[model samples]
Target: MRTLTRPAARRHIERVFDATVLDVLNSVDLVDLRVVVLQGGEQGGPPAIAIICESLGQIDLGWIETGDAPVAWRAAAYRALDQSLGRVLPIYGYQYLFDEIAMYYWDGETEDDAARQSLIAYHGADADELENMALPSEMNARRPAWMIAANAAASKRLPTALRRKLDTLDRASKALGGLESERNAWNCDFEIIQDYIPGYEECSSLPPLTLVPFEQFARELDDIARNGMEMGFMDIAGLCPLPDADRIDDWFTALRRGVQLLVAAQDLIRLDPTQL
Candidate 1:
């Protein structure tokens, strides 16, 4: 990223285009005798080269007057210039030229040339292939904890319904003492059943209660399970908000019908009737 002001970028493009025109024209001898003689200052130069240069020069003048140039040639010229400069240019200047000058009908050129050149100049070569290259080891390294926290904060700006759900989940987890248990057992190797009672309570409380329908609840649980398997438990922990423990008993009672429906479906699908 070489930072360039708008005017500077435009001037750079104009200069490159002018140089290309001159380079093409200088190789011919269609110009006046004085100009042709001037081009022959070096020994062993072909006269035909002078003629071609002059012809190209005249063509370039006409192109400048009409504000148009051949696309393939323009692309080649720009590519060469980009390679020499070793920096990306702003897309605005190219877009301006394409809209203003290239879109109109011009002598000896089609709009496709201008469009193709613009595309190449903006997108560069084979972006997909370039993306396939492996990232640096440093980029793959774990990010700082603060960065993770900041990102989580940014993403947590949920709609009111989702926010209430999250609040409910938090209260449920707190009532079940999940957070405290995790903190207490942080450094200990002990696997205590009491520590997991909160988790069981949280799940038990989530059934038919809350705004989430039974089918939606099942989908969310499935999503949590899949996410956990792929990204780890911590990543999937927030998939479901904590339910309200105070309302769990009533909620579960209300969901009995849904539960029975699910159980019936499961029983019907079982290979053996006894398995139900």
Candidate 2:
């Protein structure tokens, strides 16, 4: 039931990204950096990561002679760095600001904090960035209100499509284990539901019925019921610490919502046999 704080999640991404960038930088002799670090964004601004290097002492490169050594390194490292951080950032619930290996030089003070930071500071002007808005990280912030409806069983009953999907998921959960009660928010079965339907994880308000062909969705559910839970154990894990009482309170704050999703698949399947 414990949720990750923004600061903690941001730090996790930063650490992972720094390590990945350094490994990429060391892969080639063209780039020699004294220090590399990640500076997190302010209020959802893009994160700035820089690999500060004074000179490429070992390489006698045509590009260095042309004053495009950093540009060459960025071109070589862009794909590797992007793939690495793309895998890391989302798991911590933050957007990946597409940043790259940029160059800055300091001859007098390699170790001075203020001097080193001067060139890398956020300028409030955009440069050396690629804009890719098509893909967003899956682990972005969750909207608790959307996933668990406010009054699912009462006057604010969810649309038929959501209720139907939830019912299907509730059945698939039976194929494995499940959230035994409201006490268990970190249940593996529920996690499975979240996995199969990203709308649940992202708390996206998109209509569930149209996202995938119902027949395929139902087959996946049956396949999971037959096979997913056991394999899920290998990948799906619980939160580090245990859930607290407050989590339990939040779990059932809207009992009506819980009821809307708990209907039996047998009953639901009867209404529309195609889903099965």
Candidate 3:
């Protein structure tokens, strides 16, 4: 890892943590469901819970909550999501979407006077010189993953080797998915073949684990999904230097490690919480 100051490193870790949790929520089709359900009826539930399961069909939600295939999928999803986010986010200048929002609107910075003063401080120029600069509202929007990646690529923060690896993995994963779909269609028209093929084993979905590692991943995801809004964004720009190539490399290493662990765990009958 890059030798960042303690607070800066912590900020990066927290961002990774939040993104990983969100990734898990999305993977299990639970992005729209509440992580923790309180005493209130569903209709009168907390705002966080209200939006939970909004993206899921009733059937999908039921499977995740009660079925073996889905629960195991959830565990694997957690690992994949965590790995992907940890590797990807650092590439994009070590900044997150929330960081953009915080710059323009959060923490009582809504007023023109406050914002002007802040901008003046940032640019270290007089108000007169900064008058024609774009307002934060005009410039700000949530940065999508692709946009972040593009920014990193533009700045040369994403190394060539890492880029090629990411691209290769993405294309291979898509090809496997396509193969599965084609096979399913063929099975519909003909007979099922018990033949060996790379990734064919993945075609047979595993049951969810009843293990502690799975539970821990699920629980952490639940907490973040439910209470992430309560956690404010960091002022990374003020506190930390823009991430350089070395920092980006650190994130890439972390992400690869996460993916490797996830691949190993998915095929296992047992998972230790300690490993997670």
Candidate 4:
């Protein structure tokens, strides 16, 4: 697959993030609360979102009792932003260097640690003091391989017993043309097994084993499975798109390494669950 250029990647990032924000805002219970989008950073950068508390200090926290209240709205905004950042950023190839979210308050007048820390703590940074706050650190060039392994392991839906049933078929599909008979048998077995996997759509269509080679079909299936699995894992992991251009490939390399580690880990786990 072709990688996206930086500009196209940023556009994709903005579009997905905008959708995420809209969904979050629509769910808010307040009537007057609005989310404001402003151009962030220097020329040619993605927009930053702010939860506009129109009346600010005058807001009747009591009347606005739902999750859209000043406190909750800000919380929700950060949540949406963080979740979007975590999931979308990586697709274009980027990873957050740090865990803390950034904020620019009072019309972007000041950007001191006190302000950052207060904002972070107010919105749920678990730190006792500004010194302990972790909001404004630099982004790392690469993500740890373990994170990708975690993503893969997290995406697995089949139990060990169920997955084991495909061993013969999977092995046959890997070998030479001797697997024609094995593929046909696997197709039949998959028809029955796929049904037992409640809500699993992956194995729904068993392209007649005679029409297309099992190896070809397997590649197609793998693409579909990887997309679904990664999306699910990213959502749960709270990763976002990497805005920085320089380190995108580094992040991708880390992700590949993570996938490799995950496959190895799975093998080990299968060999001896107790030892692992």
C-alpha TM-scores of all predictions: 0.16, 0.18, 0.20, 0.19
Arranged by TM-score with the best first, the candidates are 3, 4, 2, 1
- lDDT per residue for candidate 1 within 1-276, as digits (tens), equals 799899999789658745643443343231211111112212322211111001100111111112233333223222222221111111112222222223321221234444444434543634464444222222212222211222232214433432343344333323333322222211111122113222422231111111112221233334323433443222011011112334323322222222222222222222121221
Candidate 3, residues 109-214, lDDT tens digits: the string is 5455666777677657576876675444533333222222222333133344333444444443333234322221111111111121123233212111111122
Residue 57, candidate 2: how far off, in angstroms? 5.0
Candidate 2's C-alpha runs over 4 A off are 34-46, 56-276
Which of candidates 1 and 4 reaches a greater lDDT?
4
Model 2, CA-based lDDT = 0.28
Deviation in Å, model 3, residue 100 alpha carbon:
8.2
lDDT scores for all predictions?
A: 0.26, 0.28, 0.31, 0.30
Encode model 2's per-residue lDDT on 1-276: one tens digit a residue.
767799988788669756754454443342233333223322332222222223311122122123222332222222222222111111111011111011122222223343234334542222332121111121112211111222124312434543554445444444323334333322334343443323434432111111112221243323322322332212221111113425434333222122222222223322331222
Writing each residue's lDDT as its tens digit, candidate 4 over 220-270 gives 334333444443311111111234544334333333332332232233223
Instruction: Using lDDT, give the best candidate's number.
Output: 3
Deviation from native of the Cα of residue 255 in model 1, angstroms: 18
lDDT, model 2, position 16: 79
Candidate 1: C-alpha RMSD after superposition: 38.6
Runs of candidate 1 with Cα error greater than 4 angstroms are 1-147, 153-157, 178-276
Number of the top candidate by TM-score? Answer: 3
